[model samples]
Target: QSIMMGGLIKKGSNNVESKIPLLGDIPGVGWLFKYGKKSNAKTELLVMITPYVIESDDVLAQYIKKFQEKTQGLRQGLGVKGSTAALSGKTDKPVPPGE
Candidate 1:
């Protein structure tokens, strides 16, 4: 059995504004000569964890083999290059050079 947990945290933001010195003080038409700018920043953090128990090495090996078999043709018919080699069920190790 496996358990998955996830969490997300968000932080609030700050807003700022600015304008021309004297011209900005006037009301109504004064807006024409004033430039205002506001900036808001937000931060978020996400965490996810999965926990599982395996009794022994044999059990782990069995899981790995099963995964390999299940995904044997995962890349088939995707128009990928060298697909024949991918279907060879050689997921556990890299092929040595010079054959």
Candidate 2:
């Protein structure tokens, strides 16, 4: 089976302000004499992903074993049981009440 996923991420915004030199800086009457302009620019990111599912347990196990062997050097402190749990789609932490 093949699964397709897509997402949009908005990163940042831009703001701009404009004012007359002498009139804009006035405290109370700044609105009438001076003008302030603000504009916002945002960055949009698109993420597309496709994942192929392994149907057979033996194939899945082989892939998991290969992954474990590759990552063994990097995962010195973490336990093998935790990795196995994640591979089996089992989380050690209990789910929250609402979620």
Candidate 3:
């Protein structure tokens, strides 16, 4: 997200810039422009405000249900202690003891 946000700043301005976000108000991370007449002049700003968000739904909603069903069926059909336990502990295999 840093790369994305930083790219926005690069495209927006060519003045002094800071790599950090939300710290644009800090000393040198960004620029502060001033213009006007007389001693007590007015100040202007072109601060960069970044936006971000979390996007997590397609992977979960799209495949989670299929993964659960396939895993459960493999356990029950094999009857190797099912999925709830270890297959090595199953005492019902047709082979003789250690054979």
After TM-score superposition, the amount by which residue 6's alpha carbon in candidate 1 deviates from its true location, in angstroms, is 2.9
- The prediction achieving the highest lDDT against the true structure is 2
In model 1, how large is the Cα lDDT of residue 25? 78
Off by over 4 Å in 2: 1-8, 40-42, 49-99
lDDT of 2 by residue, 1-99 (tens): 434355575655455556777787789977676555655556656565546578998888887778767676456555432243355456777644422
Query: On a 0 to 100 scale, what is the lDDT of residue 69 in model 1?
Result: 56
Instruction: Estimate, for each residue in 18-97, the C-alpha lDDT of model 3 and write its tens digit.
Output: 34455445676344432223233343444455444526765544454565577678866876443322223444645443
TM-score of 3: 0.24
TM-score, candidate number 1? 0.35
Model 1 is weakest, by summed lDDT over 10 consecutive residues, at 79-88
The deviation in Å at residue 79 for candidate 2 is 50
Worst 10 residues of 3 by lDDT: 5-14
Instruction: Provide the TM-score for each candidate, comma-separated.
Output: 0.35, 0.32, 0.24
Local accuracy of candidate 1 as per-residue lDDT tens digits, 16-80: 55667787778887787766665666665556555557899777677667655555556344433
Candidate 3 lDDT (Cα, 0 to 1):
0.45
